[model samples]
Target: MKREEFEKIVEETIESLPEEIKQKLDNVVFIVQDYPDSDELKKTKASKYNLLGLYTGIPLSKRGTSYGMYPATPDRIFIFKANIERICRNEKELKTKIREVVLHEIGHYLGMSEEEVRKALGE
Candidate 1:
């Protein structure tokens, strides 16, 4: 799929999120990259070809009173376009996979661990 179409799906998926979830997503940025970089692969310990998304920076739940006293980078959620496309064979599958990857990363941004996020997703 084209990057434009893929990005549009991502935007639509985010827009479809619950109002409460959307409201709490302050100081966060969504990025689309074709693949994971070497550093990201090492940090997440994930292989390059299969990793669908990643969340970086401090999670909201881990913040304390002093959190915003200094300038801070916004949390990042990276959606891996090529990797997602690799696993999905059709547009419907692509859309479903994108939503899953997005929601999974968002769970991490919200301070849920991998296990916690999986459980919440009934995985």
Candidate 2:
């Protein structure tokens, strides 16, 4: 998908977030990039095609008492459309996957562990 279209999906996903989750998402920017940054790839130990999304910022738990007061200087979430599309077989699957990716990143922002994310998704 084009950057605009991918971004639209991401926006839609954000709009669909649960109220409780959305309430905590202030000041964070969501961006769609062609691929994950080198730092992210290194962190995740992901092959180029393995990662569909990345959250590059302080997790809520790690942010401690100053969570909201002391903002992350360069807070952002990066979603990789090309990598996602390369794995998905169709539009429906793509959208589903995109939502999953978006939510997974949001889970990170919300201080959910990877295991928690899987349970939330019923995976």
Model 1: per-residue Cα lDDT over 1-123, one tens digit each: 999999999999999999999998978999999999997887787899879999998998998889889999998999999999999999999999999999999999999999999999887
Q: Write the per-residue lDDT of candidate 2 for residues 1-123, one digit (tens) a residue.
A: 677887898899999877887888866788887788777788797887788888878776676676667545755788888999998899889999999999988888778888998899886
Error of 2 at 78 (Å): 1.3
User: Largest TM-score belongs to which candidate?
Assistant: 1
Off by over 4 Å in 2: 68-71
Model 2 steric clash pairs: none
Off by over 4 Å in 1: none
